[model samples]
Target: YEKSSTILTSNKSYGEWGEIFKDHVIAAALLDRILHHCTTINIKGESYRLKERKKQGIKTGLIRHNSTEILEN
Candidate 1:
């Protein structure tokens, strides 16, 4: 980081990141260096996991009008 720039992306927020890094001092130091020369971008959108689940439901006929019969027949 000192010799070159770095970029990072996380699904967790800053306040929720302590749980991710699992070390207070390390997390704080890393965050300090990152925030020192970084442009933080907060991307808000539906979770990719949920979107994939919906797509899987459509593919598997889980959301069909006759889901059970579609499966049996």
Candidate 2:
């Protein structure tokens, strides 16, 4: 038998995932499964979208987030 690999990618950190899913319990379960026997790699850099905008002479500004509103119903 051969083993298969699964790949999951996210722009947010593990702690911030509850906001993305709107449920901390679900996020925990999902993460638990994916992280079991998994290897992790983190890549950091300026976003490609922002990089291209800068190249085209378009000004870009830092994006701000309000944590309180993220999981609002």
Candidate 3:
């Protein structure tokens, strides 16, 4: 485990992982192992996709229908 590197990226915070795995116990155990030998980096900013859309003069509006959302130009 020493001298090894791993990268993991997630938009969800640690507290929200339980919902993802559908079991708090499993999430906790997995996090314990991963975090035991991990370095965390939190990034905060506008999404790169949105920034690129804005730069390209693409409309960033959404049209909703029922539970689905369609992006509009």
After best superposition, candidate 3 residue 43: deviation in angstroms?
0.2
Q: What does the lDDT read for residue 5 in candidate 2?
A: 68
Candidate 1: stretches off by over 4 Å = 1-5, 56-73
Question: Local distance difference test, per candidate?
Answer: 0.61, 0.71, 0.73
For all predicted structures, in order, the TM-scores are 0.54, 0.67, 0.70
Ranked by TM-score, top first? 3, 2, 1
Q: Please tell me which model should have the higher lDDT, number 1 or number 2.
A: 2
Off by over 4 Å in 2: 62-73
Which pairs of residues collide in model 1?
Answer: none
Q: List where candidate 3 sits over 4 angstroms from the true fold.
A: 56-73
Clashes of each: 0, 0, 0
lDDT of 3 by residue, 1-73 (tens): 7677787889788899999999999999998888885567665655656778878989878432333222221
lDDT of 1 by residue, 1-73 (tens): 4687566777677776677888777878877766875566665644545668776764433332321111110
Model 1 vs. true fold: TM: 0.54
